[model samples]
Target: MQRAKFAVTLFATVMAIGLTGCGEEKKPEAPKPEAAASTPPPAATVEIKIGTVGPLTGSIAHLGKDNENGVVLAIEQANAAKITIDGKPAHFTLISEDDQADPKVGTTVAQKLVDDKVAGVVGHLNSGVTIPASAIYHQAGIPMITGSATNPQLTEQGFDNIFRVVGRDDQQGPAIASYLAATEKPKVVAVIDDSTAYGEGLADQVAKTLKSEGVKVLAREKGTDKTTDWKAVLTKIKGEKPNAVFFGGMDATGGPLMKQARELGIKAVFAFGDGACTDKMHELAGEAAEGLLCSQAGIPPQAASKAFLEAYKAKFNTDPILYAPFTYDAANLLIQAMKEANSADPKKYLPFLQKIDYSGATGKIEFDAKGDRKDAEITIFVMKNGKVEPIAVVKSGKTIPFDEFMKSMGGA
Candidate 1:
């Protein structure tokens, strides 16, 4: 039996036999130099910095982290796939900042991101923050994309550098108003806003539509961004005895407002815009959140891509909050633009971003001339038994009632 047991390739075996020559020691000739062979082409790699701004430290930190995680997960997947840009292996690094939902801090961080030379940005969840922060990005010629900020002025600023993955407040505000006027048949409603750009702007739209529909807006109240005790406003709202309360603000504040309203024995049906349409809102409002109404642009988070849901759960070990899917879409859309331009520079990719027509986690993602989604739909939900249950889908001037919507889902 042969002493060597390890198998060798045919060429290697032949070379070994020739070198040993039956175990005889033969005269060794001088070793010939190896022929010059072309070396395999080296892989090219480049580091691209991406900026993400949000209220990462204040009341909405959970939602901010969710948005940041969405971008992070997208970058992670792209890096894992070895995405190449401009003939170089592109490495994406996320640089996130906390605006604390303040317009001043938002502008400060926006300039910081500009100074850091980020190729693009995804952020400033509050429209109040995004509107002011966008100017900084525009001045530096960097692209800014937001997944959540819905205030129309954010895009109407005529800044070509600003883009969003979601629909505008113009669409969402009318949706809430229509629900109250046409569907719920409420004759009197009270409106409360956080007094920020997003909240007040949306409140104005709601109030206008309500008046047009002949629904009396019983009371219009204001709250600050940092407010936690809403008793003063709730007491004033209690006196109005409106059929419903329309809140224009983030969930961090909306949740407390809802809780206080319920505790004060004000049982008006609470309706809110997308700002408070989050999983966290349901939890924060507890049982009081039940039977509550909220409207979100497009489908529910449960309706996102299955693969995305699984991957998100695996990575974060928790369900996503509102806008995470949109954030993911924004990140990928920018990367797609970069691939089309063959460069990671925003100046090179901005034009491509303006014309993208791709299906994202949120649904068909195409931007109109104003940087708003061409025709994003809206889904209204009611909190029932600790879940935000989708009851209606409104689009194309049509409203699909809850039972019919479920029937459309194969009677789910």
Candidate 2:
């Protein structure tokens, strides 16, 4: 009887195991997706080209290099942020060409950018190069925004495609003239230029303004830009014995001129336009750079926006100068326009840029009817203890008051 009971229990356990296996087999599997839904979507890719032309190797190469570094930083930051344009992920591709600060070379590079189908250009730092390069860009229907090129003639031609983020030489020349007349009150001042368009034009404008302001113009002269020695010109300036000397060229000439002027004992509160605003001036002029003055666009370096100062220091391991903020803003303005227009095509973006009021790392950027920024500010720099120091900013409180500033300089 015990054997029979054991057999029954074993049979029941076998039946339970078979029933559990059948229950597991009855469960359904998940369905396979359709072929159309199974394939992965296309990879996201969008490219926008930004071109730059500057003196990568020559006199004033440092300034060009700084400008390029600032722009590159802007591009890198934009990419890391995953900037999008018109709902599409955007990537910035920078193509820089060394124009060597030559007008012909600038024109060649501008044409090359046109052939390469870039959306816009960011440079041609020297006014001498920017003046000629602008013509080609205008013809090619590509817009160019310059940060350092301060020649007023760039926008004076009324090219719809041209714009400047910094103050012009016209504004700078008059500001220096007024400062010399009102602040220092120099009785007699001599003017000199390196004969480049920027140099000559700036000198001439200052002479005219100073003459109008009842200040005596002792002498006006031109200097060679390529020469390392400026003793001959310094001798001429020394012979004049003016109360002050105004140089219209860049630091490449201004430095040597200051050094030679000191050797000749021609110190009379020397001042120049933004061209002379460089640490190299101190190196070139030595002790003569003390109290040297220059007028540039934007606030003092110490007062620069926190973001700009920190990024510049981190990238370059030093302080930034006048043009860095302007370059950063110029690129930001372009990106803003691209976003507003919802297209990278210039034809689509130009109109939007005209009406866009962009607040950038530099300041508030709003263009007028003439393609000129409306509220641009010009800041002056003074050298002290072999360092460039910010002095003051000539802003009209709220807006730049373009018509008024131009009228003050007889440029409107």
Candidate 3:
């Protein structure tokens, strides 16, 4: 037997012996009493709670459910792998709360999570909701990673307790503009938003960029979340004869707009941000979604790490959405940092998380000091021939130059 040194910080040590030499004159070894009939004790189980907040039972229910499913899948994977935390086998349980895409509800849920003493948090699909919810989480010292919220200001507050696995709207919004300028080159564009924080922010960013890129803004309008029929809104845009239309809202609104806009004979290209990429969009828009284009942070689930996809499928029994894989990555990265720090306390894990080079479902995930995903990849998808296909993918290690990006978008 080849012998090697074994160092175990938490428990029992092991000694290996080499039988390379048999001593002919070995002194009579005292009977070792059969090594006290050694037996292994049961592995200790430690409980860690994970909290998630999303629109679990509202217009965005599908998105929330899918994100929760992914996080559940990660917990399953961790359990099967015998994940250890603080030298003890760790098992995670999810505490899910519904925000209904409401910021006030989101804040209440965040406070509830703080009371629950969860080890980490994984969601708040809406940027508007995440913004306020994160404030509560920060004050409580509970670290959270959001997979879907894309507002640039979410982490700009520099709260150490918050992190994002997805790219912010600033990176994705202008990237869509770049795509339009380089490929479609529509002469004029019409823009509309739901008037919510997330919807308006993304729309404003894209509009600023589009105008700078020489695409004329013929009309800009707002629609209510409660309004299902956007025919009037669609009619107004169609008369502008803009070559393209950009919408900033969730599938609940975007889906109906796509269906109505097509029926209204708006021949303009319909493009949206990550908020519109849910599977629900296909169901809502039907055939109208066929030619739509959108942008999102991270690659498609199929393009993510194989282990994550396999594990996700085994647990969720369905293909993941845009944010699911990002959530899984964020959760595992948090776990990795906790283990490496050898502490579940947020303070100890904070610094390690700051410097982590995490290999997650989305790809290599690292963070800047501000808790933004570093060197993120953004993918643009176009619904073609009845399916969404990735048309362009860009990965960069440096923060996108805001001024240059603005200039390229015709906004600087």
Q: Provide the lDDT at 307 for model 2.
A: 76
TM-score of 2: 0.68
Q: State each model's CA lDDT, in order.
A: 0.82, 0.77, 0.77
Per-residue lDDT of candidate 1, residues 173-212 (tens digit)? 8777887677778878999999998888888888998899
- For 242-327, candidate 2 gives per-residue lDDT tens digits of 88888899998899888888888886888888778888899987998889988786554445456777788998898775477677
lDDT of 2 at 67: 78
Best by lDDT: 1
In the predicted model 2, the residue pairs found to clash are none
lDDT over C-alpha atoms for residue 88 of model 3: 76
- Candidate 3 residues lying further than 4 Å off, grouped into runs, are 1-47, 55-59, 83-105, 185-204, 207-270, 274-290, 297-299, 385-390, 397-412
Tens-digit lDDT track of model 3 for 315-335: 667778657888887778778
Best TM-score goes to which candidate? Answer: 2
Candidate 2 stretches with Cα past 4 Å from truth are 1-45, 58-61, 185-204, 207-268, 275-289, 297-303, 314-322, 396-412
* Model 3: worst 10 consecutive residues (lDDT sum): 30-39
